[model samples]
Target: MQPFELVTVKDVPEAIRAQAASETAQQGATVRFIAGGTNLVDYMKLNVETPRQLVDINGLPLNLIEPLPNGGLRIGALARNSEVANNKLVQERYPVLSQALLAGASTQLRNMATTAGNLLQKTRCMYYRDIAYGCNKRQPGTGCSAIDGQNRMLAILGTSEKCIASNPSDQNVALVALEAEIHITGPKGERTVPISRFYLLPGNAPERETLLDPGDLVTAITLPPVPTGAKSLYLKLRDRASYEFALASAAIVVKRQGTRIDHVRIALGGVGAVPWRSLEAEAALHGKEATAANFRAAAEAALRKAHPQTQNGFKIELAKRCLTHALTQAVA
Candidate 1:
């Protein structure tokens, strides 16, 4: 690991001041604000992230789970994954979220991982994991080796010729299906970015992962209320159950009548640069009859635009099966 300084702050304001000052004081100094350090520490150990200073923000009171006026939930950034999953309100209202979180990592790691950190976790690409390989995400303009190389865990949507690394978060996939909003704090003040727009695609620059600026902190996440007869589920397919990463997964929220689909929201994981929302599939399902045939057709429509790699062509069919299964469960 690289040599760096550590600064401990008493509050969020002080931590913000320390980060802003560091950027102004040192030209090349890189600073990272740590809360739980579940993801950051792992990356640091892998030498994927080397910061000049580590600002501890665990002092901030950003870990509360408050209920909104609209019968929705507002989850703090510092709220641990396990805490949120076990929260009575969250478990009752957003069972899909709870199931997704529980499916991720282990009980101990989930206790240390925060909502913000989970959302900010980097991709799990093999080339990005190895320091020897040239990855554009690790170092911009260096080039992406996963493009023509072995890429079975890469993306099928929002990918570019430069990078095709998949975003690997089950929680985010559930959040996307639930249509949650992310609240952030920065120098310019506070702003809310919808979970849909919070993550950027690899249009030309895959290095820019999120819409966050320097020293910006995620404050909370809010979920909107849904109508009655709305069913939601998160289905993850992996090599094995417990600790393995997803090969392909689907999060589906469907509002249905007796035998017809009213509204449907679908987001795919392990197959996109971001939590990929399948608008085409959603459109195909809405106002259509809910049947196995329709679900299969929608799944195909969702993956029609997929660009698979040499080793990952199987993902196309795998993802389709997962989506169809998720849709069936949501209807059930």
Candidate 2:
């Protein structure tokens, strides 16, 4: 742990200005915004993150969870995970998201974790977390030890030779499936980015994880209303039943008419450097009969681009099965 200065800001602009003072948004960023501190604090304790100053953004009035005029949902960045999961509207309108939230960490963590905090959640790669080991994500160009080392939990999709760390957010996978939009306020004012574009693949510069800039502050997430007859489900496969990250997980949103699939959205977690939204799988299933055969086909299409490492080859099949089962249940 490092001795750092903690400052609490009273407003959004102040918070943004405080972080904008940082030199850069990359791995060695010195300024960081803290809310809930569930994930950030953990890494800080590990000394993987050594921010010289922490800007406390808990006082800002961004905690509202409201329904939009156009039948969508607007979730404030500061809203707690438990609140979003247990909200009546969320449970009824976006059950996949609620289920995904409940499937994460534990009751205590969900209680303390904020929505934006989870949106900006870091990877859980062993090498990245332990400063002793070389990790491209933690310090770019130092070399990715996981590429040829212990990588059972690393990524198989959206992977590069330089990095193979997997995204660990169950909530992010669901958001990608729902086609959610992220609202951010930065030095240049406000901007909206789709959840699909929020996370970046760990290319040569693995230190950069998101599209957010140095002073960019995520304000809220907006979810467009689902189709009339759409059904959604979130399925997670992990080593343990609780307090464990997913080994393979699926978030599926499907609209079926009789026995035929009308529309579908599929996003995978614990397999990609980012939460992977699979247009390939959705295209495979559209206009097809809602049967096990089509579901299996879609799963195969989803993982066709997977590039597995030595120890994590099982993930390709595991993710395929997870997606197939989720699709089967969603349209049933």
Candidate 3:
């Protein structure tokens, strides 16, 4: 890591002022906001991300987890992952989210990682992390080495000629399934963006990951109310049992009326460049009987557009099975 100036701010306005002043002094300077530093510090050690100025926003009043008037949940960006997962409201109302959070890193790391940091986490692509290799994400227009290199763990969906890195966040997959909204604060003011539209695909510019601007800071995320008696589950298929990224993961929320499905939401992880919401799969299962046959059909519909590479062709079938198992568990 390079030598940088660390400025701690007590409030949001002060943090914004520090970031704005730094940007004004040095045009095109990398000024990053640090909360838990679980991801940023690791990237800094590898020299993948070298910001000259670090604005610590841990002291800001953004750590509250509250219930909205509409029966929804409001999660502050600064709230730790463990804190959110262990909260009684989250564990009871949105068990899928809690399960996803628990499926992530170890307990120590989860206690240090923040909600916003988890959402903004980068890919685990080997080529992108190592500076020796050429990566479009790390260096634009340099070419992506993962295209023809070791890409067994890369994305199978939402891939372009430029890059094929997968999104590696379990919590993000659940958020996408729940149709959560991200609340962002910037120099201009505040705005809300849906999680589905927050992440961008690796079309031509793999460098730009999220819709967040230069000075934008995520404040909170809001999840709409889940239907009464709705059941949800998160299933992850990885190389190991603990402390591993998923090779194929599914988050399913389903509401059943006797044997028929009332409503369903599905999202996939570790298979796409962004957290993939499977609307096609949901359409196939809605109003249909919650049986093994319907689950198989929905799984097929979810992975119909998948385009696998040389070494990762097995992911297509694995993701389908994972989704099917999650749906079956949710309805059972």
Tens-digit lDDT string for candidate 3 (1-332): 89888989988877776776544312333789999999999988999888898999999999999999999999999999999999999999899999999999999999999999999999999998899999988888889999889989999889899999999999999999888999998888889999988999989988888887767889999999999989888999999999999999999889999999998999999999998999999999999998999999999999999988889999999999999999988887
Task: Report the CA-based lDDT of candidate 1 relative to the real structure.
Answer: 0.87
Candidate 3: lDDT of 61?
A: 91
Off by over 4 Å in 1: 21-29
Instruction: Determine which window of 10 residues in candidate 1 has minimal summed lDDT.
Output: 20-29
TM-score for every candidate vs. truth? 0.96, 0.99, 0.97
lDDT string, candidate 2, 187-270, tens digits:
999999998888888877878889999999999999999999899999999999998999999999899888898989999999
Better of 1 and 2 by lDDT: 2
* Cα misplacement distance, residue 179 of candidate 2 (Å): 0.3
lDDT, model 1, position 249: 93
lDDT tens string, model 1, 171-215? 999999999999988878889999888898987778778888776
- Candidate 2 residue 211 C-alpha distance from true site, Å: 0.8
Candidate 2 structure, TM-score to reference? 0.99
- Using lDDT as the measure, name the better of candidate 2 and candidate 3: 2
| C-alpha RMSD in Å of predicted model 3 compared with the true structure | 1.8
Return the TM-score for candidate 1, rounded to 2 decimals. 0.96
Model 2 regions lying over 4 Å from their true place: none
